[model samples]
Target: MAISEIQSVAERPEGNELAGRVALVTGGTRGIGAAICRALAGHGASVAAGFSHDRERAEAFRAELAAGGADVTLHRGNVSSAEDCRRTVQEVVDAHGQIDILVNNAGITMDRIVSKMADADWYDVIGVNLSGTFFMSKAALEHMLERGSGRIINISSIIGQTGNVGQANYAASKSGLFGLTMSLAKEAAFSLKRAGRLEAYGAGITVNAVAPGFIETEMLDSVPEKALERIRSEVPLHRLGRPEEVARVVRFLAADASSYITGQVWAINGGQEM
Candidate 1:
Protein backbone atom coordinates (compact mmCIF):
# COMPACT_ATOMS: atom_id res chain seq x y z
CA MET A 1 0.00 0.00 0.00
CA ALA A 2 1.08 3.59 -0.55
CA ILE A 3 2.15 5.76 2.38
CA SER A 4 -0.87 7.99 1.80
CA GLU A 5 -3.20 5.03 2.23
CA ILE A 6 -1.50 4.05 5.47
CA GLN A 7 -1.80 7.61 6.73
CA SER A 8 -5.46 7.76 5.83
CA VAL A 9 -6.23 4.67 7.86
CA ALA A 10 -4.19 5.84 10.81
CA GLU A 11 -5.80 9.26 10.83
CA ARG A 12 -9.31 7.94 11.23
CA PRO A 13 -9.71 8.02 15.03
CA GLU A 14 -13.06 6.95 16.43
CA GLY A 15 -15.00 9.39 18.61
CA ASN A 16 -15.76 6.97 21.43
CA GLU A 17 -12.19 5.77 21.61
CA LEU A 18 -10.98 9.32 22.37
CA ALA A 19 -13.99 10.20 24.50
CA GLY A 20 -12.04 10.26 27.72
CA ARG A 21 -8.89 11.91 26.47
CA VAL A 22 -8.48 15.62 27.27
CA ALA A 23 -6.25 18.18 25.55
CA LEU A 24 -5.30 21.73 26.58
CA VAL A 25 -4.15 24.18 23.91
CA THR A 26 -2.85 27.59 24.90
CA GLY A 27 -3.78 30.59 22.72
CA GLY A 28 -6.13 28.36 20.85
CA THR A 29 -8.69 30.99 19.97
CA ARG A 30 -7.01 32.07 16.73
CA GLY A 31 -4.56 31.23 13.99
CA ILE A 32 -2.43 28.12 14.29
CA GLY A 33 -3.62 27.42 17.81
CA ALA A 34 -7.20 27.50 16.64
CA ALA A 35 -6.40 25.04 13.90
CA ILE A 36 -4.77 22.71 16.39
CA CYS A 37 -7.84 22.82 18.62
CA ARG A 38 -10.13 21.88 15.76
CA ALA A 39 -7.84 19.10 14.60
CA LEU A 40 -7.59 17.53 18.05
CA ALA A 41 -11.30 17.79 18.67
CA GLY A 42 -12.05 16.37 15.24
CA HIS A 43 -10.06 13.32 16.22
CA GLY A 44 -12.23 12.83 19.33
CA ALA A 45 -10.09 14.40 22.03
CA SER A 46 -12.04 16.62 24.41
CA VAL A 47 -10.39 20.02 24.06
CA ALA A 48 -9.83 23.01 26.31
CA ALA A 49 -8.61 26.05 24.35
CA GLY A 50 -7.04 28.91 26.32
CA PHE A 51 -7.15 32.55 25.29
CA SER A 52 -5.72 35.67 26.88
CA HIS A 53 -8.58 37.98 25.97
CA ASP A 54 -11.54 38.49 23.68
CA ARG A 55 -13.99 36.22 25.42
CA GLU A 56 -16.45 36.72 22.62
CA ARG A 57 -14.10 35.32 20.02
CA ALA A 58 -13.20 32.44 22.25
CA GLU A 59 -16.84 31.59 22.88
CA ALA A 60 -17.62 31.76 19.20
CA PHE A 61 -14.79 29.38 18.46
CA ARG A 62 -16.01 27.03 21.19
CA ALA A 63 -19.52 27.08 19.78
CA GLU A 64 -18.28 26.42 16.27
CA LEU A 65 -16.10 23.51 17.37
CA ALA A 66 -18.83 22.18 19.66
CA ALA A 67 -21.32 22.38 16.85
CA GLY A 68 -19.02 20.21 14.81
CA GLY A 69 -19.57 17.49 17.44
CA ALA A 70 -16.23 17.97 19.17
CA ASP A 71 -16.13 18.30 22.92
CA VAL A 72 -14.52 21.70 23.47
CA THR A 73 -14.13 24.00 26.46
CA LEU A 74 -12.90 27.60 26.46
CA HIS A 75 -10.82 28.91 29.32
CA ARG A 76 -9.71 32.54 29.63
CA GLY A 77 -6.31 33.14 31.20
CA ASN A 78 -2.95 34.74 30.63
CA VAL A 79 -0.45 32.04 29.91
CA SER A 80 2.34 34.34 31.11
CA SER A 81 0.95 34.36 34.63
CA ALA A 82 1.69 31.37 36.82
CA GLU A 83 -1.57 31.75 38.71
CA ASP A 84 -3.58 31.84 35.51
CA CYS A 85 -1.70 28.87 34.15
CA ARG A 86 -2.50 26.92 37.30
CA ARG A 87 -6.15 27.95 37.12
CA THR A 88 -6.40 26.99 33.44
CA VAL A 89 -4.98 23.55 34.13
CA GLN A 90 -7.22 23.14 37.18
CA GLU A 91 -10.26 24.08 35.14
CA VAL A 92 -9.49 21.32 32.63
CA VAL A 93 -8.86 18.80 35.40
CA ASP A 94 -12.05 19.88 37.10
CA ALA A 95 -14.05 19.36 33.92
CA HIS A 96 -12.16 16.23 32.95
CA GLY A 97 -10.37 13.89 35.32
CA GLN A 98 -7.00 14.15 33.64
CA ILE A 99 -5.11 15.83 30.80
CA ASP A 100 -3.78 13.60 28.03
CA ILE A 101 -2.30 16.30 25.80
CA LEU A 102 -0.88 19.78 26.33
CA VAL A 103 -0.21 22.15 23.41
CA ASN A 104 1.86 25.17 24.47
CA ASN A 105 1.06 27.42 21.53
CA ALA A 106 0.58 30.78 23.20
CA GLY A 107 3.22 33.30 22.20
CA ILE A 108 3.81 36.95 21.24
CA THR A 109 6.24 38.99 19.16
CA MET A 110 7.55 42.52 19.82
CA ASP A 111 9.74 43.07 16.84
CA ARG A 112 12.55 45.64 17.07
CA ILE A 113 16.27 45.75 16.51
CA VAL A 114 18.19 44.71 19.60
CA SER A 115 19.98 48.05 19.73
CA LYS A 116 16.67 49.93 19.57
CA MET A 117 14.48 47.58 21.58
CA ALA A 118 13.29 48.57 25.02
CA ASP A 119 13.85 46.29 27.98
CA ALA A 120 10.09 45.93 28.38
CA ASP A 121 9.78 44.75 24.79
CA TRP A 122 12.33 42.04 25.36
CA TYR A 123 10.73 41.02 28.66
CA ASP A 124 7.22 40.87 27.22
CA VAL A 125 8.26 38.59 24.38
CA ILE A 126 10.16 36.30 26.71
CA GLY A 127 7.37 36.37 29.27
CA VAL A 128 4.77 35.21 26.80
CA ASN A 129 6.84 32.86 24.67
CA LEU A 130 9.31 31.27 27.07
CA SER A 131 7.93 31.84 30.55
CA GLY A 132 4.41 31.00 29.48
CA THR A 133 5.52 27.63 28.15
CA PHE A 134 7.27 26.87 31.41
CA PHE A 135 4.25 27.82 33.49
CA MET A 136 1.80 25.76 31.45
CA SER A 137 4.16 22.80 31.17
CA LYS A 138 4.71 22.82 34.92
CA ALA A 139 0.98 22.84 35.58
CA ALA A 140 0.27 20.03 33.11
CA LEU A 141 3.23 17.91 34.18
CA GLU A 142 1.63 16.98 37.49
CA HIS A 143 -1.38 15.28 35.90
CA MET A 144 0.64 13.82 33.02
CA LEU A 145 3.19 12.35 35.40
CA GLU A 146 0.39 10.69 37.32
CA ARG A 147 -1.26 9.31 34.19
CA GLY A 148 2.04 7.86 32.96
CA SER A 149 1.01 8.81 29.43
CA GLY A 150 0.65 12.25 27.89
CA ARG A 151 1.85 14.41 25.01
CA ILE A 152 3.24 17.94 25.21
CA ILE A 153 3.60 19.77 21.90
CA ASN A 154 5.15 23.20 22.00
CA ILE A 155 4.71 25.58 19.04
CA SER A 156 7.95 27.23 18.09
CA SER A 157 9.10 29.24 15.02
CA ILE A 158 11.78 29.06 12.33
CA ILE A 159 12.99 32.51 13.38
CA GLY A 160 14.02 30.86 16.63
CA GLN A 161 16.55 28.80 14.72
CA THR A 162 17.60 31.19 11.93
CA GLY A 163 17.63 34.38 14.01
CA ASN A 164 15.55 36.88 12.09
CA VAL A 165 16.56 40.52 12.00
CA GLY A 166 14.50 42.98 14.09
CA GLN A 167 13.11 39.97 15.92
CA ALA A 168 15.79 39.19 18.44
CA ASN A 169 13.26 38.88 21.21
CA TYR A 170 11.12 36.44 19.28
CA ALA A 171 14.12 34.38 18.27
CA ALA A 172 15.42 34.15 21.81
CA SER A 173 12.05 33.10 23.20
CA LYS A 174 11.59 30.32 20.64
CA SER A 175 15.18 29.10 20.90
CA GLY A 176 14.61 28.79 24.63
CA LEU A 177 11.69 26.45 23.89
CA PHE A 178 13.97 24.08 22.02
CA GLY A 179 16.05 23.70 25.16
CA LEU A 180 12.95 23.19 27.26
CA THR A 181 11.65 20.46 24.93
CA MET A 182 14.80 18.36 25.24
CA SER A 183 15.14 18.92 28.97
CA LEU A 184 11.52 18.06 29.69
CA ALA A 185 11.69 15.00 27.48
CA LYS A 186 14.66 13.69 29.47
CA GLU A 187 12.95 14.39 32.79
CA ALA A 188 9.71 12.80 31.73
CA ALA A 189 11.54 9.72 30.51
CA PHE A 190 13.31 9.35 33.84
CA SER A 191 10.09 9.83 35.78
CA LEU A 192 8.32 7.19 33.72
CA LYS A 193 11.19 4.76 34.23
CA ARG A 194 11.21 5.31 37.99
CA ALA A 195 7.47 4.72 38.10
CA GLY A 196 8.06 1.27 36.51
CA ARG A 197 6.15 2.15 33.37
CA LEU A 198 8.77 1.58 30.76
CA GLU A 199 6.27 -0.02 28.43
CA ALA A 200 4.28 3.21 28.60
CA TYR A 201 7.32 5.03 27.28
CA GLY A 202 5.65 6.70 24.30
CA ALA A 203 2.14 5.99 25.49
CA GLY A 204 2.54 7.63 28.87
CA ILE A 205 3.85 10.92 27.46
CA THR A 206 6.11 12.39 24.82
CA VAL A 207 6.95 16.09 24.61
CA ASN A 208 7.78 17.63 21.23
CA ALA A 209 7.92 21.03 19.51
CA VAL A 210 6.75 22.22 16.09
CA ALA A 211 8.46 25.23 14.55
CA PRO A 212 6.66 26.85 11.64
CA GLY A 213 7.77 29.46 9.14
CA PHE A 214 5.86 32.30 7.45
CA ILE A 215 2.40 31.04 8.27
CA GLU A 216 -0.29 33.37 6.88
CA THR A 217 -2.07 34.44 10.06
CA GLU A 218 -3.33 37.68 11.54
CA MET A 219 0.20 38.31 12.70
CA LEU A 220 1.38 38.32 9.13
CA ASP A 221 -1.55 40.38 7.90
CA SER A 222 0.47 43.48 8.72
CA VAL A 223 3.38 42.46 6.53
CA PRO A 224 3.60 44.35 3.29
CA GLU A 225 2.39 42.41 0.26
CA LYS A 226 5.71 42.82 -1.52
CA ALA A 227 7.65 41.47 1.45
CA LEU A 228 5.31 38.52 1.82
CA GLU A 229 5.66 37.73 -1.86
CA ARG A 230 9.38 37.78 -1.48
CA ILE A 231 9.18 35.45 1.50
CA ARG A 232 6.89 33.11 -0.38
CA SER A 233 9.20 33.08 -3.31
CA GLU A 234 12.13 32.14 -1.09
CA VAL A 235 10.46 28.98 0.20
CA PRO A 236 11.31 25.93 -1.86
CA LEU A 237 7.66 24.93 -1.71
CA HIS A 238 6.84 28.41 -3.10
CA ARG A 239 4.19 29.19 -0.53
CA LEU A 240 3.48 29.75 3.13
CA GLY A 241 1.96 26.90 5.13
CA ARG A 242 -1.63 26.77 6.26
CA PRO A 243 -2.60 26.58 9.91
CA GLU A 244 -4.12 23.17 9.25
CA GLU A 245 -0.77 21.82 8.19
CA VAL A 246 0.73 22.63 11.56
CA ALA A 247 -2.35 21.31 13.33
CA ARG A 248 -2.01 17.93 11.65
CA VAL A 249 1.49 17.55 13.04
CA VAL A 250 0.25 18.34 16.53
CA ARG A 251 -2.52 15.80 16.16
CA PHE A 252 -0.03 13.13 15.26
CA LEU A 253 2.15 13.95 18.22
CA ALA A 254 -0.83 13.91 20.56
CA ALA A 255 -2.09 10.59 19.28
CA ASP A 256 -0.87 7.07 19.98
CA ALA A 257 0.47 6.75 16.43
CA SER A 258 3.50 8.92 17.23
CA SER A 259 4.36 7.16 20.47
CA TYR A 260 7.95 6.51 19.49
CA ILE A 261 8.74 10.13 18.60
CA THR A 262 9.50 12.56 21.39
CA GLY A 263 11.83 15.43 22.27
CA GLN A 264 12.06 16.38 18.60
CA VAL A 265 11.27 19.57 16.67
CA TRP A 266 9.10 19.20 13.57
CA ALA A 267 9.74 22.12 11.23
CA ILE A 268 6.80 22.80 8.93
CA ASN A 269 7.99 25.74 6.84
CA GLY A 270 7.60 24.45 3.32
CA GLY A 271 11.17 23.25 3.38
CA GLN A 272 12.49 26.73 4.06
CA GLU A 273 15.22 25.70 6.50
CA MET A 274 16.38 22.73 4.49
Candidate 2:
Protein backbone atom coordinates (compact mmCIF):
# COMPACT_ATOMS: atom_id res chain seq x y z
CA MET A 1 0.00 0.00 0.00
CA ALA A 2 1.05 3.57 -0.58
CA ILE A 3 2.50 5.37 2.44
CA SER A 4 -0.14 8.08 2.20
CA GLU A 5 -2.89 5.50 2.44
CA ILE A 6 -1.13 3.85 5.35
CA GLN A 7 -0.74 7.22 7.02
CA SER A 8 -4.46 7.84 6.66
CA VAL A 9 -5.41 4.54 8.26
CA ALA A 10 -6.50 4.63 11.89
CA GLU A 11 -3.44 4.08 14.08
CA ARG A 12 -5.49 3.30 17.14
CA PRO A 13 -8.70 1.70 15.84
CA GLU A 14 -9.08 -0.18 19.12
CA GLY A 15 -10.64 2.89 20.70
CA ASN A 16 -8.33 4.61 23.13
CA GLU A 17 -6.72 1.41 24.25
CA LEU A 18 -3.85 3.42 25.65
CA ALA A 19 -5.79 6.22 27.30
CA GLY A 20 -4.08 8.08 30.13
CA ARG A 21 -0.69 6.77 29.07
CA VAL A 22 2.43 8.82 28.43
CA ALA A 23 4.99 7.68 25.85
CA LEU A 24 8.44 8.89 24.77
CA VAL A 25 9.72 7.89 21.35
CA THR A 26 13.33 8.65 20.46
CA GLY A 27 14.22 9.56 16.87
CA GLY A 28 10.54 10.27 16.57
CA THR A 29 10.58 12.95 13.92
CA ARG A 30 10.42 10.78 10.80
CA GLY A 31 9.92 7.37 9.25
CA ILE A 32 9.12 4.43 11.52
CA GLY A 33 9.77 6.50 14.62
CA ALA A 34 7.31 9.20 13.53
CA ALA A 35 4.68 6.59 12.72
CA ILE A 36 5.08 5.10 16.18
CA CYS A 37 4.59 8.49 17.80
CA ARG A 38 1.40 9.12 15.83
CA ALA A 39 0.13 5.63 16.58
CA LEU A 40 0.70 5.98 20.30
CA ALA A 41 -0.81 9.45 20.35
CA GLY A 42 -3.81 8.31 18.35
CA HIS A 43 -4.34 5.60 20.96
CA GLY A 44 -4.91 8.30 23.56
CA ALA A 45 -1.38 8.38 24.89
CA SER A 46 0.31 11.73 25.44
CA VAL A 47 3.40 11.53 23.26
CA ALA A 48 6.81 13.10 23.82
CA ALA A 49 8.70 12.84 20.55
CA GLY A 50 12.50 13.10 20.81
CA PHE A 51 14.66 14.16 17.91
CA SER A 52 18.37 14.82 17.65
CA HIS A 53 18.15 17.24 14.71
CA ASP A 54 16.10 18.11 11.67
CA ARG A 55 13.92 20.92 12.90
CA GLU A 56 11.83 20.92 9.74
CA ARG A 57 10.91 17.26 10.14
CA ALA A 58 10.21 17.78 13.82
CA GLU A 59 7.83 20.67 13.10
CA ALA A 60 6.03 18.64 10.47
CA PHE A 61 5.70 15.77 12.90
CA ARG A 62 4.14 18.10 15.42
CA ALA A 63 1.76 19.39 12.78
CA GLU A 64 0.71 15.92 11.71
CA LEU A 65 -0.11 14.92 15.24
CA ALA A 66 -1.78 18.25 15.91
CA ALA A 67 -4.00 17.88 12.85
CA GLY A 68 -5.26 14.64 14.37
CA GLY A 69 -5.63 16.25 17.79
CA ALA A 70 -3.00 14.01 19.32
CA ASP A 71 -1.26 15.17 22.48
CA VAL A 72 2.28 15.11 21.14
CA THR A 73 5.13 17.29 22.33
CA LEU A 74 8.52 17.57 20.70
CA HIS A 75 11.76 17.16 22.67
CA ARG A 76 15.19 17.69 21.16
CA GLY A 77 18.13 15.58 22.40
CA ASN A 78 20.84 13.19 21.37
CA VAL A 79 20.06 9.62 22.32
CA SER A 80 23.71 8.63 22.02
CA SER A 81 24.61 10.63 25.10
CA ALA A 82 23.67 9.56 28.62
CA GLU A 83 23.24 13.10 29.85
CA ASP A 84 20.91 14.00 27.01
CA CYS A 85 18.85 10.90 27.50
CA ARG A 86 18.46 11.63 31.19
CA ARG A 87 17.58 15.25 30.51
CA THR A 88 15.06 14.32 27.86
CA VAL A 89 13.36 11.86 30.18
CA GLN A 90 13.28 14.33 33.03
CA GLU A 91 11.90 17.09 30.85
CA VAL A 92 9.10 14.84 29.66
CA VAL A 93 8.35 13.61 33.18
CA ASP A 94 8.33 17.15 34.51
CA ALA A 95 5.90 18.26 31.83
CA HIS A 96 3.73 15.15 31.45
CA GLY A 97 4.04 13.85 35.05
CA GLN A 98 5.28 10.35 34.18
CA ILE A 99 6.57 8.08 31.47
CA ASP A 100 4.24 5.18 30.92
CA ILE A 101 5.87 3.97 27.75
CA LEU A 102 9.34 4.21 26.25
CA VAL A 103 10.03 3.42 22.61
CA ASN A 104 13.77 3.15 21.92
CA ASN A 105 13.52 3.77 18.19
CA ALA A 106 16.40 6.17 17.66
CA GLY A 107 19.13 4.52 15.61
CA ILE A 108 21.83 5.19 13.03
CA THR A 109 23.87 3.13 10.59
CA MET A 110 27.40 3.66 9.32
CA ASP A 111 27.51 0.79 6.91
CA ARG A 112 30.73 -0.66 5.57
CA ILE A 113 32.42 -4.00 5.10
CA VAL A 114 34.09 -4.92 8.39
CA SER A 115 37.50 -4.82 6.79
CA LYS A 116 37.07 -1.26 5.62
CA MET A 117 34.81 0.00 8.44
CA ALA A 118 36.45 2.91 10.20
CA ASP A 119 36.66 2.92 13.99
CA ALA A 120 34.47 5.98 14.07
CA ASP A 121 31.88 4.29 11.88
CA TRP A 122 31.64 1.29 14.15
CA TYR A 123 31.55 3.34 17.35
CA ASP A 124 29.00 5.79 15.97
CA VAL A 125 26.55 3.05 14.96
CA ILE A 126 26.98 1.21 18.25
CA GLY A 127 26.67 4.36 20.32
CA VAL A 128 23.37 5.45 18.86
CA ASN A 129 21.75 2.13 18.07
CA LEU A 130 22.72 0.10 21.13
CA SER A 131 23.92 2.53 23.74
CA GLY A 132 21.02 4.89 23.08
CA THR A 133 18.55 2.15 23.88
CA PHE A 134 20.37 1.43 27.09
CA PHE A 135 20.55 5.07 28.09
CA MET A 136 16.88 5.80 27.43
CA SER A 137 15.68 2.61 29.04
CA LYS A 138 17.73 3.25 32.15
CA ALA A 139 16.55 6.83 32.42
CA ALA A 140 12.89 5.92 32.07
CA LEU A 141 13.17 2.97 34.42
CA GLU A 142 13.10 5.21 37.45
CA HIS A 143 9.58 6.51 36.82
CA MET A 144 8.29 3.24 35.49
CA LEU A 145 9.48 1.21 38.43
CA GLU A 146 8.14 3.68 40.92
CA ARG A 147 4.71 3.57 39.30
CA GLY A 148 5.01 -0.23 39.36
CA SER A 149 4.60 -0.58 35.61
CA GLY A 150 5.87 0.32 32.12
CA ARG A 151 6.52 -0.86 28.59
CA ILE A 152 10.01 -0.53 27.07
CA ILE A 153 9.98 -1.44 23.42
CA ASN A 154 13.23 -1.48 21.52
CA ILE A 155 13.21 -1.16 17.73
CA SER A 156 15.59 -3.79 16.46
CA SER A 157 16.32 -5.07 12.93
CA ILE A 158 16.40 -8.18 10.76
CA ILE A 159 20.05 -7.45 10.12
CA GLY A 160 20.67 -7.79 13.84
CA GLN A 161 19.49 -11.39 13.80
CA THR A 162 20.58 -12.52 10.35
CA GLY A 163 23.98 -11.05 9.67
CA ASN A 164 24.26 -8.48 6.91
CA VAL A 165 27.28 -8.40 4.66
CA GLY A 166 28.24 -4.76 5.24
CA GLN A 167 26.81 -4.00 8.67
CA ALA A 168 28.82 -5.76 11.30
CA ASN A 169 28.47 -2.98 13.83
CA TYR A 170 24.76 -2.51 13.26
CA ALA A 171 24.12 -6.21 13.51
CA ALA A 172 26.05 -6.48 16.74
CA SER A 173 24.18 -3.59 18.32
CA LYS A 174 20.79 -5.00 17.44
CA SER A 175 21.71 -8.45 18.64
CA GLY A 176 22.80 -6.94 21.92
CA LEU A 177 19.26 -5.67 22.47
CA PHE A 178 17.86 -9.18 22.67
CA GLY A 179 20.04 -9.86 25.66
CA LEU A 180 19.19 -6.48 27.11
CA THR A 181 15.45 -7.06 26.67
CA MET A 182 15.55 -10.36 28.50
CA SER A 183 17.75 -9.02 31.26
CA LEU A 184 15.59 -5.97 31.85
CA ALA A 185 12.43 -8.02 31.67
CA LYS A 186 13.65 -10.39 34.34
CA GLU A 187 14.98 -7.54 36.42
CA ALA A 188 11.58 -5.90 36.39
CA ALA A 189 9.99 -9.21 37.24
CA PHE A 190 12.22 -9.74 40.23
CA SER A 191 12.00 -6.16 41.43
CA LEU A 192 8.24 -6.36 41.41
CA LYS A 193 8.52 -9.68 43.14
CA ARG A 194 10.63 -8.10 45.86
CA ALA A 195 7.96 -5.48 46.30
CA GLY A 196 5.51 -8.35 46.93
CA ARG A 197 3.77 -7.65 43.63
CA LEU A 198 4.55 -10.86 41.85
CA GLU A 199 1.84 -10.64 39.30
CA ALA A 200 1.82 -12.25 35.84
CA TYR A 201 4.63 -11.44 33.41
CA GLY A 202 3.02 -8.32 32.03
CA ALA A 203 1.21 -7.11 35.10
CA GLY A 204 4.19 -5.33 36.56
CA ILE A 205 5.92 -4.21 33.35
CA THR A 206 7.00 -5.49 29.96
CA VAL A 207 10.16 -5.15 27.94
CA ASN A 208 10.13 -6.26 24.33
CA ALA A 209 11.73 -5.63 20.94
CA VAL A 210 10.23 -5.14 17.48
CA ALA A 211 12.53 -5.95 14.57
CA PRO A 212 11.44 -4.73 11.16
CA GLY A 213 12.74 -5.66 7.73
CA PHE A 214 12.77 -3.48 4.64
CA ILE A 215 10.20 -0.97 5.79
CA GLU A 216 9.26 2.05 3.70
CA THR A 217 11.36 4.63 5.53
CA GLU A 218 14.14 7.07 4.74
CA MET A 219 16.61 4.54 6.07
CA LEU A 220 15.90 2.43 3.03
CA ASP A 221 16.88 5.28 0.73
CA SER A 222 20.48 4.53 1.59
CA VAL A 223 20.21 1.03 0.22
CA PRO A 224 21.32 0.41 -3.34
CA GLU A 225 18.43 0.10 -5.78
CA LYS A 226 19.40 -3.44 -6.70
CA ALA A 227 19.61 -4.41 -3.04
CA LEU A 228 16.21 -2.87 -2.38
CA GLU A 229 14.77 -4.81 -5.31
CA ARG A 230 16.33 -7.95 -3.93
CA ILE A 231 14.76 -7.33 -0.54
CA ARG A 232 11.35 -6.81 -2.12
CA SER A 233 11.70 -9.94 -4.17
CA GLU A 234 12.63 -11.96 -1.08
CA VAL A 235 9.67 -10.82 0.96
CA PRO A 236 6.79 -13.24 0.49
CA LEU A 237 4.47 -10.24 0.39
CA HIS A 238 6.36 -8.90 -2.63
CA ARG A 239 6.70 -5.43 -1.13
CA LEU A 240 8.44 -3.60 1.62
CA GLY A 241 6.65 -3.35 4.97
CA ARG A 242 5.07 -0.04 5.88
CA PRO A 243 5.98 1.93 8.97
CA GLU A 244 2.34 1.89 10.06
CA GLU A 245 2.36 -1.88 10.18
CA VAL A 246 5.30 -1.79 12.56
CA ALA A 247 3.67 0.99 14.55
CA ARG A 248 0.54 -1.06 15.04
CA VAL A 249 2.56 -3.83 16.60
CA VAL A 250 4.12 -1.25 18.90
CA ARG A 251 0.72 0.15 19.78
CA PHE A 252 -0.50 -3.32 20.73
CA LEU A 253 2.50 -3.90 22.96
CA ALA A 254 1.91 -0.58 24.66
CA ALA A 255 -1.72 -1.28 25.48
CA ASP A 256 -3.17 -3.42 28.27
CA ALA A 257 -4.00 -6.04 25.67
CA SER A 258 -0.36 -7.13 25.64
CA SER A 259 -0.05 -7.30 29.40
CA TYR A 260 0.58 -11.02 29.43
CA ILE A 261 3.64 -10.70 27.22
CA THR A 262 7.17 -9.38 27.86
CA GLY A 263 10.79 -9.92 26.90
CA GLN A 264 9.79 -11.14 23.45
CA VAL A 265 11.23 -10.10 20.11
CA TRP A 266 8.38 -9.47 17.68
CA ALA A 267 9.45 -9.33 14.07
CA ILE A 268 7.53 -7.12 11.62
CA ASN A 269 9.17 -8.37 8.45
CA GLY A 270 7.14 -9.63 5.48
CA GLY A 271 8.57 -13.12 5.86
CA GLN A 272 11.99 -11.90 4.87
CA GLU A 273 13.81 -13.53 7.75
CA MET A 274 11.53 -16.45 8.32
Candidate 2 global Cα RMSD: 6.8
Please report the TM-score between candidate 1 and the true structure.
0.93
- For every model shown, what is its TM-score relative to the native structure? 0.93, 0.93
Clashes of each: 4, 0
Steric clash pairs (candidate 1): 148-204, 149-204, 150-204, 150-205
How many backbone overlaps does candidate 2 show?
Answer: 0
Name the runs in model 2 displaced over 4 angstroms: 1-13, 200-202
**Worst lDDT 10-window in candidate 2:** 4-13
Global local distance difference test of model 2: 0.88
- Report the Cα lDDT for residue 189, model 2: 78
